[model samples]
Target chain A: MKTIGLYKYLPIEHKESLLDLETDRPIPTRKDLLVEVKAISINPVDVKVRSPKENVEPSPKILGWDASGTVVEVGEDCKLFKLGDEVFYSGSITRQGTYSEYHLVDERIVGHKPKRITHAEAAALPLTTITAWEALFERLRINSDDVEGNKEKTILIIGGAGGVGSIAIQLAKWAGLNVVATASREESVAWVRKLGADEVINHYQSFTEQLTNLQIQEVDYILCLNHTEQHWESMGDVIRPQGKICSIVETEEPLNLNVLKNKSVTFVWEFMFTRSMYQTEDMIEQHLLLNNVSGLIDKGVLRSTMNQKLSPINASNLKKAHALVETGRTIGKVVLESF
Target chain B: MKTIGLYKYLPIEHKESLLDLETDRPIPTRKDLLVEVKAISINPVDVKVRSPKENVEPSPKILGWDASGTVVEVGEDCKLFKLGDEVFYSGSITRQGTYSEYHLVDERIVGHKPKRITHAEAAALPLTTITAWEALFERLRINSDDVEGNKEKTILIIGGAGGVGSIAIQLAKWAGLNVVATASREESVAWVRKLGADEVINHYQSFTEQLTNLQIQEVDYILCLNHTEQHWESMGDVIRPQGKICSIVETEEPLNLNVLKNKSVTFVWEFMFTRSMYQTEDMIEQHLLLNNVSGLIDKGVLRSTMNQKLSPINASNLKKAHALVETGRTIGKVVLESF
Candidate 1:
C-alpha cells in the first residue's frame, strides 16, 4: 500500500520533511474498522508533530487524524459499523493515522459520514466538529438540550475564523447563546459573522475594551481556540463569576489559577485524543457526538468547514497543507483527496 | 452590643489578636435578616483572614462565618425567613460576621436549622456543608440525583479529617459514589471511615501508593480540601481521564496546568463565598442546598461534624479556636455557643 509519512521531523521547507512510502497494509482487528481513506484534512497538530525535533523515527510515522472513508473490513467484535459503510472520524493519536491507503480506527469512535456532503468536506468536519462539540457540551458541560436556559447565556469564542471556532460559533448560536467571537482581520471577522457570530472583536486589541464597547459585561462561557496563555488573563476578566472556560492550546508557562479563584471559575482542557489515549470508559461518546454533528450538518443546522482542497494525497500536496496550517492564519480546513 | 473582632491582624498568641469590643447593633434591610446569635464555628478561613499582617483595620473586622441563631428581624424584602425562625448559615464574606451578639445576613444564604442537632452542632455544619455541597454537586458537577449511575463512580476526598471532608464523605456516600478519603493519623482515618468513607489513604504518603494498595485505578472526582499545590500532581495522576478536581485551598504558587492536558481534566476553584461576594443571580441556590442538607441531617443520612465545643463566645475563646485551626490538624469543627 502507498502511504505518506515522516522519517524525521523537519521544517516543511526541507524536501525530506514528508515522504511517499510503500508499507504493508494494516489489518482490522478487535473492534477495528479498516477504512479505505478517501479524503484527509490537515490541522495544526500535523504541523506540530512534523516540526523540527531531535529524534528520528525508525519507521516512517503517519501523522494525519481527520478522514472520510469507506469500511473495507471490520473486526470480529465491531458492533456499530460494517464493511462497505461510509464513515468519517478523527482517529486516535496513539494509533497509526489516516495518511495511508488503508487506516484502522475503532468502530466506537467512527461516525457515519454526512450523506449531504462530499468526502473532502466530511474529512474537514470530524476533527474540528469533535473538538468544538466536546469543548462546548462536554468540557464546559453546557446543556445543549436546554436551549431555553442557554438563551440567557453568552459564549466567547477566541480565534473565530479558524476551523473549530467557525463551527463553534454556529453551535453556540444554535444552542441559543449570545456569541462573541475574536478575529483579527477583515476576512476573518466577516467569515465569523457570516457563520452566525452575534458580535466580533479583534484578537489583536484589548478584549475588555472591545467587549465593553459592545456592551457585553461578562460571558457565561469561553471556548479558547487560540493561544490560551496569552488570553488567560483577559478570559478570567471577562468570564462571569462561576463561569466556565475550556481551552485546547497547551501553555508554555504556569497558570496562576488564583486569578479565577475569587470568581470560582472552572478551567478545563479539551484534548480531542483523550478518549483514545486513555481508552476511557466513554470512548463511544466521540462516535455519538460525531454522528450528532453529521446529522446536524445534513439537517442544515451546521455547515462543513472545508475551505481549501488539493488532489492526490501525496507528499507534495500534504507539504502544502502542512505549510498552510503552520502559518496559523488558515480560515478553515485544508484537505487532500484521492490517496 | 458586645462583639469580638480584630483591629489589627496578629498571631493568635497576641492578646489583641481578637478583641471583645462594643459595636453598634446592626439592622436588617433588603433581603437581610437580623439574627440574635447563639453559636459560631471556626474554620480555616478565619485563621487565614486573621493571619499576621502589617495593615490595620480602620474599624474592627469581624471574622466569623458559620453561625446558628434565631432571626430577630427581617427586612421588608425578605421572603424566605420570618422573625424568630431558627436558622444556620455560612454568611457572605462581605457582610458582618456572626461574632457579634446581633449580626445581619442575607436571607437567601440561610437555611432552616436541623431540629435533630444542637446550636453548636448546627453552627459547625454551615461552612463545611456549604463548601462540601457546592464543591461536589456544583463545581465538580457530580449528579447527586443519579445514585445508580454514581454507584459506578469514585470520589477522592483529600484532607478527609478536615471540617469539609467529614461531611463530604457522608454526602459522597449518600450520592452512591465509592469514597476514598485521605487521612494521616489513626484517629482521622477512623473518623473518615466512620463517616462512610469506603477507603482511607494516608495523605502524608504518596497518593498513588495508597490508591494502588486499595486496588483503585483512578477517581471520577476529587475534592481537594487540603493544599492543592502539594497535591496537584498526585491528583492529576490519580484522576480518570476527563475527571473533575475541585479545591478550596489556595495555591502558594502558579500551577503547571499542562500535566492534566493529556487527560482533559477539569480544575475548579470552589470558594463558598463566590455567590455572595459576586451577588450572583443564583445566590439563592445556597439556601436551597442548605435546606436539603438540613433534611439529610435530620433524616440521619448526614451528621454534624462538631467535634469540640466552647462556651461564652469571647476574645479568649476565639483566640483558642484560632490557635486550634492554625495548627492545621484540627479534626472536624470547633464551635462556641452563647454569645
Candidate 2:
C-alpha cells in the first residue's frame, strides 16, 4: 500500500516533511474494520502533531484522523459494520492514522457514511462533527432532545469560522438555542451567518461588550474553539450565573478558576480523543452520535463544511493541506481525495 | 433589637472583634421575611470575612449565615411563608446576615424548618446542605432519583469531616453512590464513617495511592471542600475519564487546567450564595431544595451535622465560634443558639 508518512517531524516547507512510500497493509482484528481509504481531511491536530520536533520515528509515522472509506474486511467480533460498508470516522489518536491506501479502525467508533454526500464531503465531517456533538450534548450537558427547553438558552461559539465551530453553530441552532458566533474576518463572518448563527461577534473584541451591545446580557453556555487562555476572562464575564463553558483548546498558561467562583460556573474540557484514548465504557457514543449526524446530513438539515478540495492523495497535496490549516485562518475544512 | 456586629475586621482574640449593639428591628418588604432569630450556626465564611483587614465599616457589619427562626412578618409578595412560620435558611451574602435579634431574608431562599429537630440542629444544616446538594445533584448533574444508575458511580469527598462533606457523604450514599471521603484525624474519620462514607482516605497522602490501597482505581466525581489548589493535581490524577469535579474552596493561586484536558473532565464551583447573590431565575431552587432537605431530615434519611453548640448568642460566643472555625479542623458544624 502507498502511504504518506514521515520519519522526521519538520516544517512543512522542508522537502522531507512528508514522504510517499510503500508499506505492507495492516489486517483487521478484534472488532476492527480494514477500510479502503477513499477521502481524507486535514485538521489542526494533524498540523500540530507533524510540527517540527526533536524526536525521530523509527518507522514512517502516519498522521491523519478524518476519513470516509469503504470497509474491505471486518474482524469476527465486529457487529456494527461489514464488508463493502461505506463508513466515516475520526480514527483513534493512538493508532496509525488514515493517511494511507488502507486503514484499520474499531467498528464501534465508525459510522455509516451519509449516502447522500460524496466521500470527499463526508471526510470533512467526522472529526469536527464528533467534537462539536460531544462538547454540546455530553460535556456541556445540553438537552438536544428538548428543543422547547433549549429555546430559552443561548450559546456563544468562539472561533465560529473554524471547522468545529461551523458545525457547532448549526447543531446548537438545531437544538433550538440562540446561537451567537464569533468571527473576525468578513468572509468568516459571512460563512458562520450562512451556517445559521443568530448573531456574529468578533473574537478580537470584548465578548461582554459585544453581547451587551447586542442586548444579550449573558449566555447560558460557551463553546470555545480558539485560544482558551486569551478568552478565559471574557468568557467568565459573559457566562450567566451557573452557566457552563466547554473548550476544545488546551491552555498554555494556568487559569485563575476563582474568576468563576462567585457565580458557581462550570468549566469543562472537550477533547475528542478522550474516549478513544481512555477506551471508556461510553466510547461507542461517538459511533452513535456520528450516525445521528449522518442522518441529519441526509435529511438536508446540515450541509457539508468542506470548503477547499485537493485531488490525488499524496505527500505534496497533504503538505499543501497542512500548510493551509497551519495558517489557522482556513474557513470550514480542506479535503484530499483519491490516492 | 440587639445585634452582634463588628466595626473593624480583627483577630478573633481581639476585644473589639465583635460587639453587642442595639438597633431598630427591620421590616419585611417585597419577597422579604422578617424572622425573629432563634439560633445560628457559624461557617468558615464567617471567619474568613472577619479576618484581620485594613478597612473599617462606618456601621457595624453583621456576620452569620445559617439560621433557624420564626417569621414574625411576611412581605406583601411573599407566598412561601406567613407570620409565625418557623423557617431555616442560609441567607444571601449580599444582604446583612443573621446575627441579630431579628433578621430579614428573602422567602425564596428560606425553607420550613425540620419539625423533628431543634433550632440549633436545623441552623447547622442550611449553608452546608445547600452547598452539598447543589454540588452533587446540580453541578455534577448526579440524578438522585436514579439510585440503580448511581450504584455504579463513586464520589470522593475531600475534607469529608467538614460541614459540607458531612452532608455530602450522606447525600451521595442516599443516592446509591459509593462514597470515599478524606479525613486525617481519628475523630474525623469516625465522624465521616458514622455519616455513611463507604471508604475513608487520608487527604494528607496521595489520593491515588490511598484509593489504590482500598482497591478502588478512581472516582466518577470529586466534591472538594478543602484546599482546591493543594488537591487540584491529586484530584486530576484520581478522577475517571470524563468525570466531574465540584469544589467550594476558592484557590489563592491559579490552576493549570490543562491537567484534566486529556480526560475531558469538568471543574465547577459550588458557591451556595450564587443564586441569591445573582438573583438568578432559579433562586427559588434554594427554598425548594431546603424544604426537601427538611423533609429528608424528618424522615430520618439525613441528619444535622452540628457536633458543638454554644448558648446565648452574643459577641463573646460568636468570637469563640469564629476561633473554632479558624482552626480548619472543626469535625462538624458549630452552632450558637438563644439570643
Top lDDT prediction, candidate number: 2
The TM-scores of all predictions, comma-separated, are 0.98, 0.99
Backbone clashes in model 2, listed as residue pairs:
none
Give RMSD to native, each candidate: 1.3, 0.8
Residue clash pairs of candidate 1: none
lDDT of 1 at A15: 92
Fnat, one value per model: 0.90, 0.95
Give the lDDT of residue A173 in candidate 2: 89
Q: Model 1 over residues B1-339: C-alpha lDDT tens digits?
A: 989998899889989999999999988889999998899999998998889999999999999999999999999999999988999998988877889999999999999999999998999999889999999999998889999999999999999999999999999999999999999999998999999999988887888888888899898999999889999999999999999999998899988999999999999999999999999999999999999999999998899999999999999999999999999999999999996
Instruction: Report the Cα lDDT for candidate 2.
Output: 0.95
lDDT of 1 by residue, A150-216 (tens): 9899899999999899889988988888899999999988899999999999987888899999988
- For each candidate, report its DockQ versus the true two-chain complex: 0.88, 0.94
Residue B162, candidate 2: Cα error in Å is 0.6
Best by TM-score: 2
Candidate 2 residues B1-339, lDDT tens each?
989999999999999999999988999899999999899999999998888999999987999998999999888999989888999999999889999999999999999999999999999999999999999999999999999999999999999999999999999999999999999999999999999999998999999888999888989999999999999999999999999999999999989999999999999999999999899999999999999999999999999999999999999999899999999999889999999
